[model samples]
Target: MGIKKQLGPIEIIVNNASVFDKLGLEEVSAQELDRHFAINVKAPFLLAKSMNEQLTTGSAGKIINLNDWRKARPTRLAYGVTKSALTGLTRTLALSLAPNIQVNEIAFGAYCHPQIYPWVDHVRISA
Candidate 1:
């Protein structure tokens, strides 16, 4: 009845869900950072871990970790920091899942996702 039942197993996972609220270093709270990391880093890590476990012998799986170019930027401090951390996580995951499950990252400088990233779509560029 569910997607897993119909599709057999999760072969490809796109860790795409994340929040990017613009916040300065002084504006970001502990809870805000925790929330951002939980969604951006922890969720993707957990999904990859679960995928590694679900994979059968000789079968390959794919994990695409979606990130933004703002990871190094000063704005959106918490989101930036979390995404930076996720890059490290992705690298380690790729090493751990070698030959079977491949983990990769997709960094977007400009993109649109009305539901998840409404701001990106409406952001104005003066340059």
Candidate 2:
């Protein structure tokens, strides 16, 4: 069965996929940066674009992008840059898709598995 037949309609999209590869300034390669952009930024943009019709068909729609609170991370240069770009994309999409779809970003702080992300010390959500 097609997605429409199974799910009815897509009302909410949560973009949570991200890459946090550790790379220093000198270690960051062109391919690495492109990979980060392709997954972290382009994927979400394309998904939203492709689902625009379905999203706007409903009375209300929401697109939420998961982002990191830290603006800069020297340990993961390319990852940080792509995340920053995602923030801009969220803000721009919100204005562009107004009255139909609501685009927002949830910034997380130091939240990751200890083994996967040894750099992250703790996870805290604050108002």
Candidate 3:
């Protein structure tokens, strides 16, 4: 018996929990990669599975996954890999949970202090 079952129905779920550790390809260990997948990918899948019944019963259920847009950054090797997998998960879930639950993803760009990333101005200008 989970909170969703106890409370009856759930209309929306936001999968925002993620682990962003800056580690290069060579620096990332197997355990770190597993951890990244567990938190960034598996957790959302489990949550959505658990809430499937309640979500289907709702008038309009929604599931939003917080993702990242930067894909080729070498510093975020494992993180990027997991996020890419999550993107696929979002697409798959959108198809599988259709008619009842709407699955979507919000991909974010680089988020750092303006002073730390002066190049952000170029992105802003280009956009």
Instruction: Provide TM-scores for the models.
Output: 0.81, 0.82, 0.82
Q: Which segments of candidate 3 are over 4 A away from where they belong?
A: 55-59, 115-127
lDDT of 3 at 11: 76
> Quick one: ranking by lDDT, best first?
1, 2, 3
Residue by residue across 1-127, what tens digits does model 3's lDDT show? 9875688677788999998899998999999999999999999998788667655443777899999887556888989899999999999999998878889999987655564375554534333
Tens-digit per-residue lDDT, 1-127, candidate 1: 9876788778899999997888989889999999998999999999998888877898999999998875765778888889999999999999999989998999987543344464454544454
Model 2 CA deviation exceeding 4 Å by range: 56-58, 111-127
Model 3 residue pairs with clashes: none
| TM-score of decoy 2 | 0.82
List all candidate RMSDs to the true structure: 5.5, 4.6, 3.5
Winner of 1 and 3 under lDDT = 1
Error of 2 at 91 (Å): 0.3
**Candidate 2 lowest-lDDT run of ten:** 111-120
